[model samples]
Every structure is written in structure tokens, then in C-alpha cells.
Target: MNEIVKTSAFIGAQPYSPDEFEAAIRAVGAERYHDKHPFHKMLHGGQLNKEQVRAWALNRYCYQEAVPRKDAAFMSRVHDRELRREWIHRIHDHDGLGEEGGGIERWLVLTDALGFSREYVTSRRGALPATKFAVEAYVRFVVEQPLVIAVASSLTELFAPAIHRERIAGMLANYDFVDDRVMAYFKRRLAQAPRDSEFALNYIKTNALTRAEQEGCIAAVRFKCDVLWAQLDALHYAYVTPGLVPPGAYRPGQATE
Candidate 1:
């Protein structure tokens, strides 16, 4: 174990009340959330042209594609029927029930408007290596981490509504290509993310009884924030300054015609 985990695991070092623990988790979001990333700032500020926007939509599809799989992986380990029942709704929200078409479908709508074919977006053929690595790491984290920490890792959703709101407003105001239909993903997430994050925050507050466990939960959120931030870093590195587009990753003018 690393020194940070060792320090966090030391019981009774700092016992937090439920409110304090919740604050610590929020603090992680405040400090580490990907909204602070430069690429997101550029995206929201209309600094990116159409292809840059397409690159983002394409790369982000990889994360959207992973959401239900990670949720299902977490659900698979739960023995409690009620918890499973509650958690199954997340899968429904992402993968959709029947023909309702959930978040993944809505995200593809954005990519499609950006001129990427559904096949290209879903195939993830254009995703950055760093984007794939970061997203897959999140799936593995949920699959391997203790259940409580796995749930806690999702607390990044607490910060999602603000970013989604920013995205909807910014994209609409800044880009001619963005309309309500193109931004349906963020609009839906405004409601879904809050509902999901509330349940997750309450779950952590109620369940993380020990100081060590609470710290671990905090670390989990921090780790998830890193996962998100890393994706933006990859985007900015490839599409922005010092533009080093890695092998087989999406490049400008490469969108489907």
C-alpha cells in the first residue's frame, strides 16, 4: 500500500461526523472535477471549432459506453435485493428500457449531429488511448474495489449537474451546430445525475461507519475525479496545445462524411 492509503487506513486518526465526511467528498469534487480542465473550458467557451467538438463527443462516447457495464458489474456483487433494485435503475437509465433509449442513445444523438456515424461512435475506433485507458480503469475500479467504495466513486455525479448546465447553455450560445436536440444528453443528465448522486452520497454517509472507511470513500471520489480529469487532459493534449494525436486516435477532418 502507498503512504496515502496507509495514512487514510489508520483508524481513529480523524473521525468525521456524517456531515464532515460528506463535506470531504464534496471537497474532492471541488478540487479535482474535470470541469476545471482546460479542454472543458475551451469546449464551453466556444474556443473549439466543429471538429474539436466532434473529437470530444467521439472520445466521450467511450465513457458513456462504459457506464452501464460498470454499474452492472457493481450490481452483480450486491447480495441485497433492495440495493440491487435501486441500483438496477441506473442501468435502465443508461442502457434504457425497451425502446425508450437511455443516456447512451442520447449521447449518440450528439455525435451523430456532429457528423460521426453511429457505427464510428459506438465502435470507439476513434477514441484516444488515454481515453480508453482512463475509462477502462474506472470499470476495473468498480469491479475490484469494495462495494461501498465502488458506490462512493460515483459521487462525481454530484458535480455533474453544474457541468451539464454549463454545457447546455454554453453549447447553445456558442455553436451554430448545437441545438436542443444536439444537447439532449446534457439535458437528461441534469436530472439523472442529481438523482443518482444523491442516492450515492446518502449511501456513503450511512454506510461508511469507520473513519478509515470514510477516508477510503473520500479517496474513491478523488480517484474517480482523476479518471474524469485524465480524459480531458488527453483531449487537450491531443486537440489543443502541444497537439500530439496518438496513433489511430481521431484527428481533424476525420469525421464521417
Candidate 2:
């Protein structure tokens, strides 16, 4: 294994206390997730090209689509009606009643404004290899983990509002093609993320009463952060320095620059 992977694996095996795991959750977001990714740094610093920004929106659509599916997996496991009803809203938020609404549709609108065909974006034809792995890992986490831990995994939403705002402001300022309307997805997320994250956090905190359970909750969030971080690493590796674009994915030569 590579040095980074080897080190991370070694660290992953270490035992963690509940408070330590909680700190690790915050640290992972602070240190690992795409918020600190150079791509995001460039985007927030108003340095990304239009194509790069479009690439981000297109790739991110996969993650958006997966959110509700994972939520559904968690929802199916819950026997409580009140919590299930509240959780169902997450699915509705992403899926909507019949398109033209919800996160997926909003993501498509962003891609559409960026000049991508709706079919291409939705089909995920040119998406990066890492994007698929990370997004699928999230869905699998909810599907495989216990309900409490699955709910806690969604806490990445806790770190999303600020990233959403930064991305919106930066994209508007940096890209001539980006307008307020093109970025409706981010606008909705800015408001919705806190509400969703609040619910998940309260659920975790209340339900994870024992120290070990609380630690598992924290680990779930960290795992979620790793999922996001891995995606950025893929993008950075493929589209940035050492540019190893995966086969079957869109390339700058074949795609609009």
C-alpha cells in the first residue's frame, strides 16, 4: 500500500474513546473532507475555470443522488413513525414528487446551465472512479450499519452549509457563466443542511447513550468524512497534478474546455 493509505490504515485500527472519536469526527471534517481540498480552495479563492466548476457540479450530482437512497435504507430499518416521517423528508428533499424540484433536479439545472446534456450528467457517464467509490461507500454504510450509526453518518451535512456558501460565492465571482439562478442547488442546501444535520445530531446524541455507542456514532461521521475526502483526492489526482484521468471518464480533450 501507499504511504498515505498505510498510515491511515494503521491509524484506523487504533482503539478510540468516545470523546476522542467525537474529536476525530470534527478533525476529519476539519482536516480530511473536500472543504480543505485544493479544488475547493481554488473554487473558493475564485480561481477555477468554468470547465472545472462544471466538473465539480457534474460529479457532485452522484453524491446528491445517493443521499436519499442511503436515507431510505436507514428509514426502512426504523420502526418509529415520528422519526421515520422526519427521515422521509430527507428522501423527499432529494427525490421530490416528480422532478423539477428536489436536490437531484437542482443539481441537473446547475449542470444544464453549465452546458451539460441532462442525460450525460444523470447517466454519470464521465464521472471519476473515486466519485463512484466514495458515494457508493456512503450508501453501503447506511445499508450495512445499525440504524443509529447510519443516522450519525449523515452528520457530514453538519459541515456542508459553510462549504455550500463558499462554493456559491466563489463560483459566482470566479466563473462568468455562473449566475444566481444556476446555483439554486447550493441556495437550497444552505438552508436545508442545518435542519437535516440538527435532526441527525440530536438523534445520535440522544440515542447513543453508552460511551461505546457514542464512539460508534462518531466513527460513522468520520467514515462519512473519509468518503467525501476520497472523492476530492480522486479529482485532484486525475484532474490536477499527476493527472491520471481514469479510462471511460470524460477528458478535457473530448469534453468542452
lDDT of 1 by residue, 1-257 (tens): 23224544575576699889988999998898999998999999999988889889999999999999999999989999999999999999989999889999999888888888898888888899999999999998888877888999999999999999998999999999999998988888888998999999899888878777788899899999999999999988998888889989988986453
Q: Where does model 2 exceed 4 Å of error?
A: 1-27, 98-100, 253-257
Q: lDDT at 136 for candidate 2?
A: 90
The residue-by-residue lDDT of candidate 2 on 26-117, one tens digit each, is 77577666788787797778776666666677788888888888888887788899989898888888888764378888888888888888
For every model shown, the clashing-pair count is: 0, 0
lDDT score of residue 174 within candidate 2: 74
lDDT of 1: 0.89
Q: Which residue pairs clash within candidate 1?
A: none
Query: How close to the true structure is residue 200 of candidate 2, measured as C-alpha lDDT?
Result: 79
lDDT of each: 0.89, 0.77
- Model 2 TM: 0.87
The residue pairs found clashing in candidate 2 are: none
Model 1 residue 173 CA deviation (Å) reads 0.4
